[model samples]
Target: MGSRRHTWVRRLGAAWLAAAAVVGTAASSAAASAPTPTKSTAGPTPAELKRVDAHAEKQRERLRLPGMALAVVKDDEVVHRRTWGKDGDGKPITRQTPFLVGSLSKPITSTAVMRLAEAGSLRLDAPVRRYLPWFRPSGPSADRITLRNLLNQTSGLSERDGIAHADRFDNAPGGVERTARGLAGARTGAPPGERHEYSNANYMLLGAVVEKVTGQPFGDYLRKSVLRPFGMDGTLVDERDAERRELAPGHRYFFGHPKRFDPPYDASGVPYGYVGADIDDLSRFAVAHLGHGDAAARAVVSPAGLRELHKGTVPAGTSHRYGLGWRDDSFEGERVVWHGGATPGYHGTVVLAPERGLAVVVQDNAYSPQRDELLNATALGAMRILLGGRPAAASTDPMLDAMLTTVTVTAAVLALALLWSLFRIFRPSRGRPRGRRRIVVGAAVSVTGLLVLAVTAVYVLPRQVTVDLSEILLFVPDTGWLLVAIGVLATALAVTRGGLAVRACLAAPPLARTDPDAVRDRRQEARAGV
Candidate 1:
């Protein structure tokens, strides 16, 4: 079944590529008639890159981030790029590593759909039910949900009736069918196209449609049509299962102790599967969009689709003016086209400045508090210098970065010291060993660590960092830190409890020493020595 499904996706993907080529040809002719942008190789300078690095680091620190990978593009070329911090386990991260780009898949999917449209195989404004007669939104809303709405996120429908659940049921056997059934029977919060609401269900359903229309699975289609053409060879999709190729682990903080990065798939369990790409591959994607497939000159999106994708399909400010697959808006008076992606343990944001011929992509294994603000600020500052704008003030949040450095180093030192002390104290004493003394010391350290972690996670850290709903703490917020603290405390307590249990057994009295049975008993006693 999987093989058959993949075959269908491949055929559709080929058809889409053929269509993209035809569209590219026509668009190129048209672009020749339009006004050209001022081009430059003098992208953001090294000093600007330095500022960006510092700012991104601060954002990482503020959010308790494990690691981040970034790519900056200017005039169809990679002007700057970097990887910062550690992997899911605080192991250092590298630019070649992959991090999940969650809903960012939507734009890629939309682009493929547009290629189909260019082929005259589909239309954006068509009723989705037309393609799949079995597909329909629940009740009266059925007639209102269009392909355009699904792309723009203004569809009056949501997955699971707006209720959240833990498992990735949408990807399970018959999950897609069940989800389609749920939507067909579901109700909407707003009238069709009345408002824009981000819904994963929208894209998952779209994935199914792409499959149905092209007779291919989403991932296979993406690889053949998008990734291959754009040179995003390092990009990965649907990491529901682990694969070792260039993947980064995801993580979340355990309550009072240090933030625990999770195993790759376990780290951040995203509902829908995602596309994971390294910084360089992502930059290539950015260049494709900026270049729009003009091999001689650089461009990614077909100019017509790119323009349409940027046009506000939903009302501006009604819900961030969602377009075909991306969002369009003015950030600090500069027209910015971008999207933000979040999956279980990972957070990412991509910003593109069409006028400046510049783009930025930021990906983190764990959520970063600063997010696009610091990255965006740094990008803008760099652009200012390049464009000869007035010098901006120092935005390198030194205090936050310094504090984070101190905390991390101190924690490592303390943990190592504690371990060393524990090994010494727990070792059988050369003479007059006291089991009770060892227990007392272990319990004291464990309890003290737990208390300190609780204070930091619950009060100190949360107070110290600025928490925002739309930022890194979107899902858990107060509860996330609380969960982390509690998990840590529980682990510490478990260790102490095990030690105490061992102590109890060792402290028991011997029944007999002379008998062979007594000797056997004595060996057990020695094995359980305090």
Candidate 2:
């Protein structure tokens, strides 16, 4: 009886083992057929996205921005997006509204160059002349400038020189080539790779090089290789593209208020600062950079190549390093990769926290030199909010307010002074001195001083500010026109004062002939009488 029980137990055990194997096989097959989950699938919760939206809105209101668009991405998914106010066209800003992204185009251009490099079509360390033989900037070391130098902005191009050539508003074809050729006369301030200096000219030349190598228009190449592949269909590469899409206008700060500014399209600037795109387009770009298994990004650039683009190659500042086109810096002790862009009427910022898998893009319709820091901070604040930190309260820029106030007060004073001078010129005062020699000397001195002041205002001041007069007018019409008004008023005042002096001298009665003989006779007659 015991032997029989043992046999039965063995048979049941074998059957049980077989059944277990069959069930495991079925389970494995089901698991293999199920869809794979992605990190983006578990992105930031809705509540978190709502917080980011609220913070962004608050910042827009606090900054008094006329229009703004913001997007937040977690991993490869856009978790939140919002738009406020109106665009340059007075239409409510939407996901499709395009803003001139300014220097943000640098990164996009850099990616294109990198793509070519990866394909072995170009070498980063090769001199620019290898592609464009006519390329020669005015510097002894110009021959040493390599494609990498331009990519990292260490080609020794000066910001002042860049400003000199920027914002030409040239809408004609071949504008990029013309501008690049124009750089032959430009002098570099330092040796190639010696230091990093941000210059739009660097990218403009790169655009030219791309055209030469690819035998295609820069815009066409960019569209085929970068924009289209990345699904940025709304991005406008040049003036024609912008017009075709009816690109919205941007705003500039005038007396601390945002005003619509319909800037002329600059086709030459497309490679560096003129590329336009809406928020949705930029969100895709941000996702690609995050590298969270984005198929489109992978197809455009290899993972290693993307990493190289973000690597800090040179020191940009004490706290910042510049990669190919991105700035690597720390924000509140966290690694942040970012770039800030500003044209005349728009300001935008893209901030990425790679370690945290977070990206934020903030764009404001209005831009001002004084408000640049504040505008950029909005993106940083959004990042902080996403990281579970309360955003810092928006702070008013007292300095900007003071500057606008000073500009207004100075303008009024200049007008008053000019009117008073004109009044004095037309209606001479009885108490005015009647000495012709003194009047002539004073007028000559006053005219010379006024001429010097006018020249300095027109020339020296723009250099000191590191922008041309036209840029000042484009970005800050009030200040730009004020500079012009100052020159005009100073000259007018000088001319009127000099004219008054000349007229006074000519109108003065000929000095009474103090005849020495007459004086002597009078003295002799007095002596005789005595």
Candidate 3:
């Protein structure tokens, strides 16, 4: 059983690695072949809008999405706005239906921080401790972290640390402050400002900083300073407000099927990932960011401040850069400022091409870790259509359905094998092992291999995916529990085999063990059995 489970796990790993390689190659080739962004003064034509709508509907049906909302804005006007499918309540989704816009909240929070800076309330380059004297993490370098470092995600906090504190579902008072203070126990992978490591902890501390400086809750200040000015009237900064607006319950994929998941409000995560908005609300925010004669956009932040917010100050990857809250990158060689966000059950993306005076906002009620890239493609594909280019070929959904199916079948086989092993260990033996020494050695090797497999599955695999086991369990319960089952069954099998080997050694005949001919005969018998 241990050997069989090990083989299954190895096969799963190999499949994942191969899939990743294929995706990487496809992405690189797409980028290389993408045409340069063309500056167009005209908006998307009616036929173009039709194509966009058709594409959205195709994707929704193909992915079996529960609900979705999309809006395309040109200059200061929304040229196209549409919705398809139903919400958790079975009502049709609308422009005003609130959906949790995960890390898209970062831009709004960053906007609030910039407003404070514009009024001389705080300095971007100043150490965080300058404002919040209690601000201190474990490392000495923590003291040198500036507001800018957090904004650009160069505060030295790793993704692992962020996942550790994320999705806390803590609705209690002072959760944000508590999360910030709790970082005193968190370890940093690098010194502040030395590397760009995205972490929700950075924005959590920023939320605390906002609270300390403004003497108001992070939500309150963000609404007054950012949302209101941008005409995002349908937006809500916290769970209570979202509930009042009847925020649509989001969905999580279970074996390729969408299941409703009404996750608890994470108050501590609002600044980084939990803000809620509808398509209309996001469209207005996009228009504001575009800043092409939109008075609301001009009034909220100065040209200099807006530029700073979209500037790529730190490198994130080969072609991507992290700005204050936005990601500066290219879509088809066209410069685009964008950000995509996800929680347990929702996915959303906002893309802005200021040069072309175009912006796109796409939001869906369903989300899954495996479908993250595919969901993001919805927004990118829309942008491509608007840019008068054919959208890139759609990639596969990362084979999540296949992976989960394999896990299920493998678990069943392992369970049966474990049961058979247990029965063999307890049932009356047909005969004692003639090669007791060989049996013991083989069992020892099996136990050692099983233990190594268990450790790798429970620990190393999660790190390779840049998350912890807890996160996997929280987001992908089926996969997580199946992994636990495999490890447990392997251990059980190891114990049973070891016990049988020990019993054989104890029952062996001493004369047979001392005789070379008998030993050879026993070895032949054991080989035949094997």
Predicted model with the maximum lDDT: 3
How many times do residue backbones clash in model 3? 0
Off by over 4 Å in 1: 1-42, 89-91, 139-141, 159-181, 240-242, 254-258, 261-273, 292-301, 316-320, 368-530
Q: How far off is residue 370 in model 1, in Å?
A: 10
Task: For each candidate in the order shown, give its overall lDDT on alpha carbons.
Answer: 0.55, 0.74, 0.76
lDDT of 1 by residue, 1-530 (tens): 00001111222224323432442243211111211244744568787677677766765675556677777778667767777777764567787777777656667777777767776777788888887677655655667677888788777764333223212324444344454444554556676678776665566566667667777666666777777788876677544433756465575433311244443332111223366777777777766665443452233345666677666557534334678767776544456677666555666666776666778787777533213234334434434443445324544233333333333443454455446545644773455434454555666666555455434433444333332212224333334433343435434544654565466436633324334687887789889993
Give per-residue CA lDDT, model 3, range 277-384, as digits (tens).
989889988888876434565677776787788877778767778889988887766778888888777889999887778898999988766666678778888898
Clashes of each: 20, 0, 0
The estimated TM-scores of all candidates read 0.62, 0.85, 0.84
Q: Is candidate 1 or candidate 3 better by lDDT?
A: 3
Q: Ten consecutive residues with minimal summed lDDT in candidate 2? A: 28-37
Q: After superposition, how far is residue 473 of candidate 2 from its true place, in Å?
A: 1.3
In angstroms, give how far residue 238 of model 2 lies from its true place. 2.3
Error of 1 at 166 (Å): 7.7
